[model samples]
Target: MAGNTDPLSPRAKLAVTAGRAAAAASRAVGRGSGSVIGGKVALRLDPDLLARLATHLDVVLVSATNGKTTTTRLIAEALRASGPVVSNALGANMPAGITSALAGGSDAKYGVIEVDEKYLSTVARDVTPKAIALLNLSRDQLDRAAETRMLAEKWREGLAGSKALVVANADDPLIVWAASSSANVVWVAAGQEWKDDAWSCPSCGGVMQRPGDDWFCGECGFRRPTPSWALSGDHVLDPHGSAWPIKLQLPGRANKANATTSAAVAAAFGVPPQIALERMYSVQAVAGRYDVVSFMQRELRLLLAKNPAGWLETFSLIDPPPTPVILSVNARGADGTDTSWLWDVDYTRLAGHPIFVIGDRKLDLAVRLEVAGLDFQVCEDVDEAVRQAPPGRIEVIANYTAFQDLRRRVGN
Candidate 1:
């Protein structure tokens, strides 16, 4: 159905009403992110509310350790060409968030949902999505997500039961293993520069080789799948060698990878590359991921990276030493209580740079920088850090709540 505007069933209607009331209450009290807590209450009231509202809608679920939020935003924007597409704009990927978006947009027939890595299986099993995009697996929120390998195993279990078409990143061995059991798959070569996550094959402890840049495991013979879509330089290429050039407002290799994977998802749903690419270029930011905002009265580029894999990619975007950069971290519930993943990232590469460390976890990062030989000064306050950073092109990278808190502070 193009537009499913029919009224929700009585149970679902009641759940949605209660959820809206909860959201209103939260907003009234300024207790939390209204998008999250309200939907949680609704799901508690009616566990099956999401399945009911999503029954008649076309759903596309995007799950990844790094790019799912931006990717979902891109896909959701592309799907709007068809009609209204439902999605949570905030980086809310849990069941509550999914229900919140659905309850608010009951009339929308198309959905582009960003799912949390650990919760993807449960959500997919319930939604039976029309398409699934598995970007990459890496250590993220260790306290909350357990480990990446366990996440991969859960994905494998989920895929065995999923009937949806999977758009998987073939560059990462972990993603290949997770989607290997899928009935329908469209592989995309959206580059994975960080090989730390794929140290040994996810399926086998066998050492993997890049035969023609496609990973192949030596022991159990698990291998990289051929990509039907990929990014060749600046152009998005098809399997038959045709290419579509995309000009993005968002920068970085990570974002390009996100855009290419999103195009593959769009293509699986019958959207031509041209249409998807056009909409992708229009996306400037996802809840302030790549926003250029003034902090301490100076314009600075903002980036969010919550884990090692993300930090590695974002670090690559840094120009060089003496280019002012601020590293912010936090150990909030949203950011996971464990800040140990900081040790996993190769901050040694940060040596020879002018760095200003900021956040509640700023001391922890400063210690790591001292060990890595990166000369950095610690400024616990966000505004103070901004005031002290070298006067020039400034870049700020913050994790989870640390980033949100800054966005809120500088928000006008």
Candidate 2:
């Protein structure tokens, strides 16, 4: 049975009970999911509530600028093949939300947590995971988060001398440098399409030499490690030299990349790669991402792109031109108040599509599109934009807050 409180101390048990009540109240009022508020209330009542609950479960923390939630979901699903698993399937990666999730799934044998990149160290200290997935690090929420290189450095410092087995991306130079200090690491050659952030070496601030798939810094002589797992076009090659075709229901190379690391992480937990991959095939949509919602007599497939790197991957996933694309962006606290990252994304790729833009920062996106020699219509909202579109299925791509707005609107 889930939410069993017998293992917790009296103080922690009371905290968990109060947190559940608050969560129920929040959902009743429709303020939000109540995950974060509930956790905050519990933590305030008991500071060590997370650590107390985590002591009974084998935890795994997944952190990355993109694909954190999806990868966490895949890892959790894979672990479920062995026993019960609990996770923050929603995009609430902070401490409070994580606490609430752990409290709800008290009896789960495995705890798969999706942690925000900025809060990874703090959460890692409390959870003491059995394994940690270090995915690619790139620019995201520049106003709120630190630079990618600095984040990599922080990860290196945080994981130093830790006992957890690290499953990391070998293709990403930043990821490689970050996980270098861990005693045990399983490197996976998950492709990095966005390389603007890692051209310079994080080690000696020297220019990195990238001849082909290999990368190395000339000044400090830091080089790419040999990956035990590598991703070829449509298949993943394991440490044993055997290749398996990655047949996931999810779309794009990015999701395929995510699946590769997920399988490796599941292997750390004693689940076979084949079994993990089989479980991952069932996860079609993650927190409304890649979810195709029917709206106004047309199908709208939602995709999330929070940064330049994310936008690049999203371009490949969206349906080709002729089909309308609704791009919504918001400059709220969640989306990063500074909209300067807009200029970093290449809007030219979307030139052929009939684009409909909406959101708080629609004007900012429209300006960028215009400068890139593209035509777009700035609509009042998603409903207006969809009603004005031609027909058939359309793609709705948005940033963090804007994505949530559309997800709520369509009831995804």
Candidate 3:
């Protein structure tokens, strides 16, 4: 029902048509959702397709090392209270996928875009989003995506002088520096679990001082700002001091933070916080993340953790001791070819769980687990790993590509 309302130029229309055909062919051939390829084809036909398609819509861009896809989905669903909303719901954050998504939902009143951390500036320049959500910044895909501070600098430079309202996490120093340059910004006290990458001040390069919950730079005097919205335990407090209990179908503290941010962004677009939170409580999963599906006669709770920061959050979400945990890692290009980051994860926290390692980089993970003094069994695949468990239900934590492969294999 979401279609384009504005009349496109002759070339853009042809590009959209060609992109849809390419996507259809990809789905027919089982190569996957053809979103990237279709967008590639469409862009080849019209280089300015994204900018052209994004015109005349109130757009919101969500970018973060983690939770961008889930947050994007939540924002889109909440904005549905306004009208039909379009989004790249499959976790495709690049420009091509975004263009394809916009092309398909041309008539939708609102566009919720999930942008890659590196591509945020480019997409923002094209779409001119009404509100942009800047979640926490952490080290992820270091082989390709730049370090956290560098990304923060890039975001700061790119967003300078932009008129869009920025809703950013106040708990992260890197995010604080990045969103600081925006003219109109809303800071949310969404807690940051991974602090290793932000020890030094991004502003004056001074050693950051952390006294309990407050963080400040000794040299430059930059400190955590007073947040307009904050997450307190399971409740979200608005700037006016009213507290609302966050009841989301999604589990984990990370998702509660995401919901708080989503509520703030939705409010920026004219939806009230109460209404936005109510609308987001129904989203049980995003793409394939956190999906509990039946696989090999055992209930498998699939969790995606691609970096140390993600793994830290994932560790808290898994089943407790005695419940078997399967950790999958892959060194595919999508999962970051350099598996050295595996050493950064504290696998010893998974000490008591019956841990099983699987995937292409299972041996690499095994070595890290060995160094961490944890016992783990190396398995060939998910079925083999699940077969070794005592049946009933098991937890499976995987990196990006491995997560996708498992989702496809399990038909989830």
Top of the candidates by lDDT? 2
Query: What are the candidates' C-alpha RMSDs?
Result: 1.6, 1.5, 1.4
Show pairs that collide, candidate 3. 3-107, 4-106, 4-107
Instruction: State the lDDT of candidate 1 residue by residue for 51-147, as single tens digits.
Output: 8778878899999888889999999887777778889878778999889988777668787899988889889877879999999998887788757
Clashing residue pairs, candidate 2?
none
User: Tens digit of lDDT per residue, candidate 2, span 254-327?
Assistant: 99999999989988888988888888999989988999998777899999999999999999988888889999
Off by over 4 Å in 3: 1-5
Best-to-worst lDDT order: 2, 3, 1
Pick the winner on TM-score between candidates 1 and 2. Answer: 2
What is candidate 3's lDDT per residue for 7-48, written digit by digit as tens? Answer: 589999999999999999999999989999999999999998
lDDT of 2: 0.92
Flag regions of model 1 displaced more than 4 Å.
Answer: 2-7
